[model samples]
Target: MSCEKVLALLNDWLDDELDASQRGQVRGHLDNCVSCAQSERSLRNVKLLVQAKADRGEPSDGLRNRVVDRLTHERAQGPTSLRWTRSPWLRAAAVLLVLASGFVIYSVVISGKLPSIAHATVAEESLARHIGTGVEGPVEPRWPFETIEDAQRVLERELGTATKLPIRSEQLKFKGASPTTYGSARGVRLFCEYKGRPFSIFALESIPDEVRQRSQCCFCRRKDDRYLVACWAARDLYFSMVGTDLTEGEFMAQLMAR
Candidate 1:
């Protein structure tokens, strides 16, 4: 199978969802193709990491109990009988319950006002976008050091110590590409390799009001490549990064460290 086909099937293959014949074919191709071999290895590592995390534990029992109780209450109050639904009190109670459920979902999913599984999922997705889209294209050598301490020293010299944000490389697992410009208005954008992966980082003094209003950004990649991007505002600085050649989880881990 072609590389593209293999890539599309990669997630399923990793999950062991592929049929026996397909799995054998993919394994055979991987044995002969260096690029496919590397991709498979990376995906396997990511699966292992995710499985390890899941094995640690689920959400607290208290949270699970609350969710179960709410569902049970909803079922009990649900249309008891055809005539019961016509009663005004029952109708009002049903409306109130719907509103309450909506509020709970919004709090957990949208506003992130609650500590729940949904909140954690959203945060992880945000981090993945930030780290994955920040960098694109060929991997670049890290600022010339094997250790975080050395990276910190180099970053201090280049960016200075005026900001509170700490610069540490212990978390940087990959680096990619020499810095490049995204567009004139956005200024110089460079692709950095961290934790053995690529991310795009931008140094913008001030984000345009229009960009902030829309909360939308654009990213480009080679025709067949996939990328994830995330952006944030830090004081007067605005930064966005894209990830390529890395799993979403791996990219998020690197970004959260920042």
Candidate 2:
């Protein structure tokens, strides 16, 4: 089996979803491929760690009583009314533990301390290159769209207003369309500055298909730093911008406003 096919099947194999023959093929490939074996081991370890942490605490008496009471109430109504009772506290705790574990794993992976599995190595290299030169060098040239008419004209010439919403310059301080890079890929982006701060928006034409699939729509801040980035998609367009000046909430507000 090919590496990609094996990698895809590994999850199903771990879940015991495969029949004997398919499982044998996967096992054979894994036995010969050190890289795939390491990946499988790492994934299994991470899952086990997260599960162990999530299962650390038992539900309290109060929670147990609530569950029993809810179940009893349902039973009194009819067997057809029966449903599983959920513990909100347990759910919240599980979510917190998973996030914490994921953060630790991400930190380890980003710091280049992880094992040299092929996929992990490629991810590390890609992140490094993106951080090193993605947003560095010359700043994108700002188009002079000072007046309302000028803004409309620039948008018309460069992007054309057909795709963009009408200008709301009255609500902003510095309003114009500018080009910037999104993530690690080279692309043209749009910007609309609010007050003295800038909120960048990306044109749909510029972003690559791969990046849009992986990242979330909300803003992300670099660890131990003030840099904030907000990303969103509108119709065919995708946008992400970074600035250290605004809080995450403020950045998200600006993005929603646009």
Best by TM-score: 2
- Write one digit per residue (lDDT tens) for candidate 1, span 48-82: 98887767765886998788765654443345233
Candidate 2 ranges beyond 4 A from true positions = 1-168, 175-178, 183-186, 204-206, 209-212, 233-236, 249-258
Residues 1-258 of candidate 2 have per-residue lDDT tens digits of 999999998778887999999999999999999999998898888778787787677777699778875565444323321210122111222232233334435656787654221111112233223422445334344321123344344433333223233333443333544444436334443445545676543332223444444432333455533455434332223434445466544543443344
TM-score for each model: 0.28, 0.31
Q: Report RMSD (Å) for each prediction in the order shown.
A: 28.0, 25.9
